[model samples]
Target: MVSDFRKKKLLHVFTSFFDRNGSGSIDKKDFELAIENISKLRGWSSGDAKYVETQSALLKIWEALQSRADSDKDGEISVDEWISMWDEFAKNPSAPLEWQNLYSKFIFNLEDASGDGVIDGEEFSSVYESFGLSKSDALVAFKKMSKGKGQVSWSEFQELWKEYFTTEDVAAPGNFIFGKTSF
Candidate 1:
């Protein structure tokens, strides 16, 4: 989360994470769970997460939120507290990780709305507005991710990201998105 674009990217990922959750919030325990998963994902495999989100995940996300969250000097968090934290993060997705955690706390125990073990084309499509991805772009992303049907796993996410996410924030691609994103 360095440049404006990276912040945008982080927000994109964050929004999706929040949307997938039934309550739209997360606590320390929830944050730890996400890190646990990321930690387990030691290596990449056919699109699997580079890291499953264990210590790495917790530390990263918490660092990301440190700036605005952690309101109480206590250090632990609750679901409501987390929601408020993410809201601020959403407003400034690229702010300093001075108070945030890059990989750990932000993405643990993600509540997949689709119940598919991962976010899917339909899920992403539904959430595109929050991510700032156009329906068309989201559709394109969905198509590439689905490759057919079902939810898009983290491994598949890598491939899809490479496709939809530009190599650089250099130039906007022509017709960035095409077709329709459907369930």
Candidate 2:
């Protein structure tokens, strides 16, 4: 089960990414702005291959978020909807198994920068860095998850992703998925 503190941390991470305008909600515009922001961070020009790839992945994530959190069918996700989704996950995370799986798969694909269906240390580190984790903290988490392996496979990644969202263990490597949270 997810602890209250962990739940709050996850919510904070989600809000940080999705609430681009700091408007307490995620709408299409905010989602698009997030894509542009990441594109700039990665130094992707409009016609670059990597830019296209990034846009594709962002679109997938955007659609998934809207499908899951747009409860009013109004094309926007209110803060209530966001919290409700988290509460539902906290209560019975498996209830939204399909969405979770799809979201995780999208993340895995995005992180597989080599297109090899695996996350190498650098790729894993990038994921952690995106959440503002320090390099040392990310390395520690990667080492823990990899267990001496040079890379983490899709199965392992999926397991870690689920644990990060569902488990309350403070020391779980997955707990570091979003850097450290003050609980």
Candidate 3:
């Protein structure tokens, strides 16, 4: 956990990131911009990192934001709502999730969409449709994830997760845009 002082600093920085306009509040676009900025800084691939746009991971983030921001039927986040969400985050920072396990489970869940622990194209497509991603995304992910010549096994998924998630900056990884920051 971060100290209150650090959390406060994080809050300030995050709010600044979210407050794109001079209105001193966050709208959906501002939040999306913040997500985009994080990807820039973190060197996250479009598929690896999430934005407010539709994607499996993004859906989860948006769900949390909806619970926090979509109050009073405004479909937008007021300053108060933004502060409330910020406070919630300060009080309980999201645990640093392990990406390897996360990626594995993501594929497995897609494979086992029916909850029977089996994978089919139909099931994988369900997860893809949920994220507005194409079935080709899964195919590509699988192709890269697969180590053996023929088919991908669960173990191969882990290797793919590491290689994809742990690229040495975005340039080292494909399909990632790079940004330069000054010291």
Candidate 4:
């Protein structure tokens, strides 16, 4: 079961990223908006390879989320439904679900703009800035997340990603992964 603190963290992600249309639920339209926003942030014009790849990745995420979380089959995932889905995953933290792995990989790839298999401070800040977080906050968060290492490798990011979803420790560096969450 997800604790209150973890639920708060999950809710932050839902509101901040998934519910892009402010429609009170997650649906295909929200993913579409995310694709547009992220592609625009990366300066990937329409028909560009990057744009097409992003479209494919995000749509796959949406499909996975909808199939797993939309319990009512309403073509949208309510906050309660989202929490419920995560609760099941939290029951076995050692085995992450497919969508979780996919989402993490997507985020890592998105943030690793240099294609160097690691995310530097600038790359981290730029991606979060696109999510509407301030660059200063992102840098601070990255510093915490990287433990002053100046960059985060894929293995490190995967651990932080898992910690973000599973740990209730307010002081965990993973808490800052999305940039200065109130929780």
lDDT of 3: 0.43
For residue 25, what is the lDDT in candidate 4?
95
C-alpha lDDT of residue 90 in model 3: 37
- Per lDDT, the best of the predicted structures is 4
- The alpha-carbon deviation from the true structure for residue 149 of candidate 4, after best TM-score superposition, in angstroms, is 1.2
**Candidate 3 per-residue C-alpha lDDT over 1-183 given as tens digits, one digit per residue, 9 for 90 to 100:** 334443443344335434655466555566455456545543556776232232445335545565555677566666566555445543433332343234246445434545554444455444443433456654444333332133434554344334332333332311110011110
Root-mean-square deviation (CA) per prediction: 11.1, 3.1, 12.9, 1.2
TM-score of 3: 0.33
| Candidate 4 Cα errors over 4 Å, as ranges | none
Give me the runs in candidate 2 sitting further than 4 Å from their true place.
1-3, 90-99, 147-149, 179-183
Write down the lDDT of every candidate, Cα atoms only. Answer: 0.43, 0.69, 0.43, 0.88
The window of 10 residues in a row where model 3 has the poorest summed lDDT is: 174-183
Model 1 spans > 4 angstroms off? 1-28, 39-54, 63-67, 90-141, 144-183
* Ordered list by lDDT, greatest first: 4, 2, 1, 3
**Which of candidates 1 and 4 is the stronger one according to lDDT?**
4
lDDT of 4 by residue, 1-183 (tens): 678898899898999889999999999999999999998999998799999999999999888888888899999999999898878876777797777788999999999998999999999999888888899988988988888898899999988987888787888888877876457
Summing lDDT over every window of 10 consecutive residues in candidate 1, give the lowest-scoring window: 174-183
State the lDDT at 173 in candidate 3.
18
- Select the stronger candidate by TM-score from 2 and 4: 4
Full-model lDDT, candidate 4: 0.88
